[model samples]
Target: PSNNETEQHSSQVDQIEEEPVRYELPLRTNRDVPPKRYTPEKEARRSRYPMANIAKGNLSPEAQIFTTSLYFEEISTSVEQALESKV
Candidate 1:
C-alpha cells in the first residue's frame, strides 16, 4: 500500500484502539451480587417465591414459622458459639 494510505489506516487503527468499549451494569447491593431489580415480569415471578415474599414482609405462616425457627436455631448455635469463642 501507499505511504498515505498505510498512515491513514494506522491512524484509524489507533483511534479504534484508543476508545474502550464500555458496558452498562445494573445496580448492585455489593461487589459480588447484583441487586434484584423489579420489572413487571420479575415481580410476577418473584411473587411465588417464598424467600422473595419474606424479603417483602409478605411471608406466609408456614414460611414465617420455618424462617423464625431457622433464625433462632442459627442464632442460638452460631451467636452463642461466637460469644463463647470471643469471635
Candidate 2:
C-alpha cells in the first residue's frame, strides 16, 4: 500500500510538469486628449466671423476679391525684361 501511494504521488508530479505555464500582460491604451468633434452649425458660426490671423500668399485679402492691374504689373514687367534680354 505504501509503494502504491508513492507511485500515485510520482504520477501526479509528472502530470503537473507535462502541463504548460502561461504569462499574462496588461493592455495598453492612448493617454492623449481626444480631438474635438465637427459640427455644421459650429462651422457656420466660425465662417460668419472675420479671420484674425494674418493673410498668407503674395496677394492681400482685399486684392484677392478684385485682382487689379497693380498685382500683375510686376509679373508683366519681369516677362518683358526677359523677352528683351533674349532678343
TM for every model, in the order presented, reads: 0.23, 0.22
Q: Report the Cα lDDT for candidate 1.
A: 0.71
Residue-by-residue lDDT tens digits, candidate 1, 16-56: 88968889898765878766775556433344556434563
lDDT of 2 by residue, 6-77 (tens): 999999999988968778766556447565586556544455445444254666877665554444454435
Question: Superposing every Cα of model 1 onto the true structure, what RMSD results?
Answer: 15.3
Worst 10 residues of 2 by lDDT: 47-56
What is the lDDT for 40 in model 2?
A: 52
Q: Stretches of candidate 2 above 4 Å error?
A: 21-87
Q: Best-fitting candidate, measured by TM-score?
A: 1
The lDDT of each candidate is 0.71, 0.64
Candidate 2 to truth, TM: 0.22
Query: Where is the poorest 10-residue window by lDDT in model 1?
Result: 43-52
Given candidate 2, what's the lDDT at residue 30? 48
